[model samples]
Target: MSARRSARRDLRRLSGVALTSLWLTSLGLPAVFSAPVSAGAAGSWVGDAPSVRLYTPGREVVSQPFLPPGTPMSAEITSVSWRFTPPPGSARLETRLCHPQRCLWLATPRGQSRALAGLAATGPFVMRFRLPESARPSAPLRIEGLQLIVNYH
Candidate 1:
């Protein structure tokens, strides 16, 4: 009798789980029952130059590579994003992100903030800035409140 009760209980539990998964699927959500959750180390840091008042065309200003936000010495980076004041007029500002191994350039600005993709690394990473010679700013171009955020798991 005890063994029969245990088997019935197990069937009920399995049926409940299957029903829950089907309900979640109907709602277009993942069935996360007993799934392992991944932990992430993600944070933002101030650039070595918080702001640049001097606008030197065609010169690359490099910031010292900053340490990872927490304990992510060898974690794979998943994303990069930035916030900064855009250069005035037609001046196109560019930013470069580098790990010891390689670099990636963020896209030209359509606004003050952007989330960029295609960066993968385990980092202590460096940042570089440039205003190209082709840019024709009617006013002085100043970069302010430059910040970088790194995300990894």
Candidate 2:
């Protein structure tokens, strides 16, 4: 009778451990395999007849552009800015843009400049460009060249 009782207790403990492990596995694996979801909807605007594409953390790419010439052309991204809050307990905001010739790195800085090297694939990416102070909204900026390749991981 004591042997039977010991076996029953061991089975109960094993069942409890198995259920706990299963629950943990279900909760942990989705976060590991899936992409981080964004908190709010992404937005876009066009300047100088250029195109804008925004990729949210939920793996949705929103493409918006004002094709002035009625033909598809590369949009000059003068500025890109956004606020991101990453998931808890892990580093987030790894985004980048790459072209055939080079890549550019975007950072949260207060200035206007061009990126010398290819874009880095990490962090809170913010970019600013030097546009003429007198530039008007109606004035069409020539953006017939270049393409923007965006990525986030």
Candidate 3:
């Protein structure tokens, strides 16, 4: 009882704002959550978790298996600002965001091009990028600045 009181007091002092609400779970645990008073830009979606760099390969003459899988599909994406950087000798790349049987490829104009079209159903999905058999990277590839606008339903 006193601990919950102390927690509430601490949060109040820390937030420096009016107390919204406090929730106590069946397990007798008090949790604090906050909501932004002002909304972000129109048509924006931030995932509960950030997108992560899948893998960074080292220099060697062997094939890396592939990316395992990503978080289950939670929302539909509307627009994307995505970029992938491959090292020297890396070209003729084919990238895909795939379901087990069906897949969607990244539509990029820089190298070869394929456009991403349609929605990916919610389920397990893996991203696979293939380099031409004759091509190899001397350094690891870096995925940078990926921002997605999502359709939340």
Candidate 4:
């Protein structure tokens, strides 16, 4: 009888974990359940926060990887998704796409106050933060974890 009860308890625990993973996947956030939660060090970017505070009117290069001269990529960004914390306190998130020439630079706005209303643009955005102040300054807003969801052909 004792052995049977122990087995039953173990089964329930496993079941719960499975259910949780499934639920997260359904929400399009499988990173929480996967072992490799992040691409940066230690599976997350919580240790570092944005240092730039003044939102400026210049273009700040975020991530632009150079291929092996002749490398090819047919990736068309369908959408993007990001998760952050130490979060905006009371401020919201906005998406800014720096469309320069033929390059699209994705940028997240950083702010120090709750009134970051002028720091972002209101539109159909995901995983992108847009700050209104368009001047080049130091880092301000800090993001914990950001994930960009893309569909490749």
User: Per-residue alpha-carbon lDDT of model 3 for 52-140, expressed as tens digits?
Assistant: 33233332222222221342343333333334444444455566544445555666613221233234323233445555556555644
lDDT, candidates in the order shown: 0.61, 0.34, 0.40, 0.36
Best by lDDT: 1
What residue pairs clash in candidate 3, if any at all?
107-114
- In model 3, which range of ten residues has the least summed lDDT? 59-68
- Estimate, for each residue in 68-139, the C-alpha lDDT of model 1 and write its tens digit: 545445455556665666644546667776667677676753222223333344466666778787865556
Better of 1 and 3 by lDDT: 1
Model 4 lDDT, full chain set? 0.36
Candidates by TM-score, descending order = 1, 3, 4, 2
Error of 3 at 68 (Å): 18
Question: What digit string (tens of lDDT, one per residue) describes model 4 on residues 1-153?
Answer: 699999999999989988988888899986354464232221111112232232333323242221112112322232323334424452443443322222233333432211212121211123334444443325565544433222212
Q: What is the TM-score (0 to 1) of candidate 1? A: 0.52
* Model 3 spans > 4 angstroms off: 1-89, 109-125, 146-149
Stretches off by above 4 angstroms in model 2 are: 1-75, 92-94, 99-101, 106-153
lDDT of 2 at 55: 27
Residue 58 of model 1 has an lDDT of 82
